[model samples]
Target: MPRGRGNRRQQDPIGGREQLPQWVRKEAQQPQRVVRNLRRRPPADADEEAPLEKRRRVDERQLVAMHPDVDFQKLLGGCDRLYKSKDLREPITIDILIRLNAALRHVCSSRYETIMFQTALNLAFAAFLRVSEFALSSNVIHEHVLHRRDVYIDHVKNQLFVTIKFSKTDQKGRSTTLVVDKNESNEICPLHSLKAFLQIRPGNDGPVLNKGL
Candidate 1:
């Protein structure tokens, strides 16, 4: 085991989702008819409730929720361009990832955030995971949230399997699995990075990517 003092990674771990309510379901679904009705009515200038961009994001979220496989993420990029509006996010171009890896090498912290997040970034890219798919949802329990038990790495086969307990796309809680296999590209190879991350054994229980010591 890697030698380090006790760290209070996440002072608490939720035991189950029954303890929490999924606000997204109620917030995101609006009977399509309601969506259409809302579109027909122009907002009053004095109402000033939510910004147009906020509405745009909700619309985009609906699109992604409905057609999870159509590369709506890319389509949303076009929306930003045509609307002459910009999303704060940018695509992970080759140059940016390279620069990110270089920077990760120099991050100094008590919780091993540098190594932890760097490995996670590599894994997320290889696994094509949405952050929400693995990250903790407020008030969610460990059974529904990710734990160290969820990751399985086959060093001999150079593969990894991550059990995704829940996803917006997988509403049935069927525990969708994500695979990360060795790729020809060494610079961005997730398998190798994950191997390195495992060597540290972040802990057997706790959020895989912890925020602090």
Candidate 2:
């Protein structure tokens, strides 16, 4: 019987069925390659876990075998100590604030700047205000920022009322009023400093410490 093209068997140059074409071998190996890759890949949960979380799990497992009296949190306090030891911030005292005001008098370019700095320093110290409470983030003014309208001076009572609309502690926007009284010293008194700044301050509605004013 004569063999047709479709009935003929195709063989490699080596004349062996085992030695097939490169594409045919590749196609046959693809399933095995995929299986090997799947075996090497980590589980989804393991991949998502952080190094700290992994360390915590290991510690927890070790803790299960340890004594009940062992305080893990107390042991972790060492890390906090190491972090705090590197911190550079120091507590600001009254003496430091006074010295800073004196330095500003010489360093400030103009009387406007001097008064502004002095007022801000004293007010922040007296009111225990964060930088965000009394100062704008940038040149742009926001509705939540302390404005001229927020300040009310009671000359009769000799007190200054400053309304803080937004604060870290008060996220709900429930406003809080700070009452600043006159001090014996004219230099560091928040009320006196504020009054001095207001005298030269422009009669415009904006942030209390704005340079544009």
Candidate 3:
């Protein structure tokens, strides 16, 4: 004979209570015990100074003790002078850039190479670009390196938009577009030089500056 649904025994709501020891079960049946609140230990004394502050105080005392007659401001100024750079790098001027362009024209073996070098120099000077921004460190092309596709020419606006995908300042790969306007001089005009270079540049995708092979 099959058992009916109503004939089955009902389970205890607290099923695991039977498995517990009698003492534990008895304790559980009683009201919950009062629990004392726990608290973190009090912070260090408010009057106590930080390690750096203490060190600074100690340093000041030593300085005063050793050099009682020396002026504190003058001593600090003298210390600062010790770390200052002595080498002064001369800034690049327009005359230097023009001379460089002229030198490249004579030095480059082919017109293609000359245009490429000239355009790069002009673009870098006008945009204030770092060498790593546009040029590849190795022979292999990186995603961050400027590509031919990254350059856009606006004939109507007479401006060229160059996208810098990565730079020292922009480590997060947040790209920035630099707008270079047409220069008055044909020799140093980035837009004019870029246009001439693009005309001869290969249609294949790669770094903007490449061997015209």
Question: Which candidate gets the maximum lDDT versus the true structure?
Answer: 3
Can you write out model 3's per-residue Cα lDDT over 1-213, one digit (the tens) per residue?
464433445445677333544455588999863435446322335325555455676777798888899889888899889888787877678999999999996899999999999999999999998889888778524888889989999999999999998888998888999999999998999999999998899875988987775
Error of 2 at 207 (Å): 0.5
For all candidates in order, the CA lDDT equals 0.68, 0.81, 0.83
Q: Give the TM-score of candidate 1.
A: 0.52
Query: Which candidate do you rate higher for TM-score, 2 or 3?
Result: 2
Q: Residue 83 in candidate 2 has what lDDT?
A: 71
Model 3 stretches astray by more than 4 angstroms: 1-88, 139-141
TM-score attained by model 3:
0.58
User: Model 1, 1-213: lDDT tens per residue?
Assistant: 542333223322565333222354465665543233655544545346547645666776687788788897678688888888556887786677778877876775533666667777777777777777656667555566656778888878888888888776876788877777887766677777666666676456876665534
Task: Arrange candidates by TM-score, descending.
Answer: 2, 3, 1
The per-residue C-alpha lDDT of model 2 at residue 152 equals: 90
| Each prediction's TM-score versus the true structure | 0.52, 0.59, 0.58
Name the regions of candidate 2 deviating beyond 4 angstroms.
1-86, 139-141
